[model samples]
Target: MSTLDAWTHGEHTHDGTTHPVYRRGTGPGVVVIHEIPGMTPEFLAFADEVVEAGFTVVLPHLFGTPGRPVGAGYVLDTVRRVCVSNEFTKLATGVTTPLAGWLRSLARELHAELGGPGVGALGMCFTGGFALAMMVDTAVVAPVLAQPSAPFPVGPTRSRDVNLSPEDLAVVKERAAGGCQVMGLRYRQDPAVGQRFETLAHELGDAFVRVEFPGRKHSTLTLHRQQEAVDRVLGFLDEKLRA
Candidate 1:
């Protein structure tokens, strides 16, 4: 059986759209949204680590083939799909992906069931900013962005944009004012991340916790997984969701 086959599978429906969710572990909830190439082995492994750390972890499959390796061809294929998907806001600045509402709904449901302070969400790569968007729901207490590359990082505006519409961003800022902190990780030289960190700092102020590493590493929990980043995220989840 595939790795996902061993996990409890279900569909999270919101706004008439549904996506597959693979869940495991027990305790407070933590939703792990995968990158462009879907839930690869590395992503699953990272989710497993979150589970072992005592959170009921849910892995949502957004795009690409689950369990596939991140080869150049696989990456390109997934990129094509995401670039064309209406759920994503590729090449568009100052717009939050519509898919974030669905994700926030899922987080609300998870928190309702798990019964914690709230739930934790960690998004990597293409899905990274989704966690930030979900924060508008208030139930998402711990939102971690791992190399959040959205709006395609195409031009100057796209590069600096946080992908959150003004209204949604206002809500996120309000949440930050209420003591919610968002964590972000990226390599200093990763062009894909652009200047989102700077935007996040300006918007979130002291509530934005940025964890930066040196070199050109892209993925924080996979591909170029940084042990320190992983540990920091786990600790943040514990502090926000468990305590």
Candidate 2:
């Protein structure tokens, strides 16, 4: 069952673009990265728990699927949106992606508002590895990569890529060398994340902890639905944010 709590919704700006932000509670700040379907109710419910745990939560809806205010038939709409929302032709080639830049701008905004030097960041599923990339900024001190989607390359090579860009991986390596801990979770039966992705778990050395639930699958977030997991996440935030 979800916590079913309401969040204080607001908007923030970055790179001349505005993004939706849902938040509540008051204390240290934590950024909650959404999954594939964007900022759905379930994801917000999870953020609510983070707020209730006593930290202010900031969740960004990066992709502007504007005018989607209602959750009516959300499951189906989300499916179409995630799987095949756009069908336009690619007229141009090799356009530099803005994801990494946008993420950094968001980190700056949160750090400024929190009146702090560092803040916590979490990325889930499609956005899982994003948190690690955010560590490129020293302000992103504690990073959580939950059920991180396997980094797969596009096209023929098809080898499991860590998904993060080479430059960003270098940043993470630096953070790990500086003693920052990275934690992650994934289901045992998730075909999306194979032994290859496990290389990421090994790459972090002892700094990374991957917890496995034997019967769990890809949707571990919705499977166990454990209150204790939320507690542990909060504990992690408390430990990282306090000192």
Candidate 3:
């Protein structure tokens, strides 16, 4: 059986949409959104680390097989699904994917049940920018974007867009302006991330704390799994959710 078989699974529903969510640990809440190809072992390991760090980690299975390995076939299947799904903007720029709204609702519900300076959110890869979009709601205070790649990074416009709707972007800007900072991680040479960090810096000003590394390493918490970045993420969570 897969390691995910041991995680407590449930469904989180919002606006008539329900997604499977795997939760573990207790105390402050921290939603850890997975990357492409489903909730792989690497992603689950990262979630376990967050749980060990003393927060209830929620991993929502948005796509792909729940516990499938990362292979070319799995990757292609997930990519195709995301491309056709209305939940994601896929090729669109300057528009928040409709799925982000549901995620925000999930964050709000989690926070309402277990409160401590609000809940934390960490989105990686395809779902990386989702945490930023979820920040439009006050419940998500600790937002972490790990190599956020959405809208496919196909062209210049999509590369620079943060994947947020105009109204949601305005709310994020206002929140950042009001002292709610957002953390981000990316490799300087990772094409998947495009110019997202540059756009974030331009939009969020001093509120965006970026931890950029050299080379083409991707996925700060998994796959590449930089120890320093992982520690930084846990530290950020502690500071935001614990203290």
Off by over 4 Å in 1: none
RMSD of 2: 4.7
RMSD each, Å = 1.3, 4.7, 1.2
lDDT (10s digit) by residue, model 1, range 201-232 = 99999999989999987997888988999999
Local distance difference test scores for all models = 0.90, 0.64, 0.90
* Candidate 1 TM-score to native: 0.97
lDDT of 2 by residue, 117-177 (tens): 4788898765676777777788787788777653432332222455555676777777887
After the best TM-score superposition of candidate 3, give how far the Cα of residue 93 lies from its true spot, in angstroms: 1.0
Candidate 1 weakest ten by summed lDDT? 1-10
The whole-model C-alpha lDDT of candidate 2 against the native structure comes to 0.64
lDDT of 2 at 151: 44
